[model samples]
Target: MPEQDDAEREFDLKWADNAERKEPSARARMLAARWKENPPEPQPFRADPDPAGPRRSSWISTVIVLGSVAAIILLLGYANFRAPY
Candidate 1:
């Protein structure tokens, strides 16, 4: 074999000799190629009005969860009051 330069000595070409090579999925490769050919436009940066605060779905979820807990607590309290110790 010919002498390899220092630049090419970083990697051993025979590393793939016994190793099982993993390849990306067809869809991933297609997307990568498409991205290289025609990259998508970047979205304009904008500050969120309330990033940490509750979003619509988050508020709904919070209401549902808290409501359920409250209902259960009320039901237990009512049952305890109506029944004898």
Candidate 2:
């Protein structure tokens, strides 16, 4: 404490306090230590060939939804023209 600067002493004290107050899981500790030693590599960037093109699943769902809406509108129109119950 005497040899260390104010900031270093404060950091050591804070580190000790955190270590005492919170105990990390074995897996968490291992991962954190590993990351400190060797960080994971970032993925290489790749530009999309067709960013504006619709995805198959999304396009199909949209078509189904539009068809359902059209059917409902037609049913309501037909009901409106029918005789009162």
Candidate 3:
């Protein structure tokens, strides 16, 4: 019983000492120091206008929309002015 208690006490002390330590690697600290001395500059963000002409998809989409509108108009006109049976 006494030996078990001593073992538990030693384990607890070892864990506590390990938990309090936080030592970074020598190489990591040196690199961080160098970065701080000569930090990188920020880049500018821009959305330059596209130099290419209009796309084919845009023209196709416009044609499809116009055709649909014309078909709907014709359908409505025919339904309103149909000959009597």
What lDDT score belongs to each candidate, Candidate 1 first? Answer: 0.83, 0.87, 0.84
lDDT of 1 by residue, 1-85 (tens): 9999865764565565546986889999999999999997775578555568545787888999999999999999999999987
Candidate 2 per-residue lDDT, tens place, 1-85, comes to 3599899999999899888467889999999999999997775588555678655788799999999999999999999889587
Top lDDT hit: 2
Any runs in candidate 2 off by more than 4 Å, and if so which?
1-33, 44-54, 57-62, 83-85
Candidate 1 collision pairs: none
lDDT per residue for candidate 3 within 2-79, as digits (tens), equals: 456888899998887888677889998998999899976664577445557766788799999999999999999898
Window of ten residues with lowest summed lDDT in model 3? 42-51
Provide backbone clash counts, one per model: 0, 0, 0
Error of 2 at 51 (Å): 15
Model 1 regions more than 4 Å off: 1-56
**Per-candidate TM-score against the hidden true structure:** 0.35, 0.35, 0.33
| Pairs of residues at least 3 apart in sequence or in different chains that clash in candidate 2 | none
How many residue pairs clash in model 2?
0
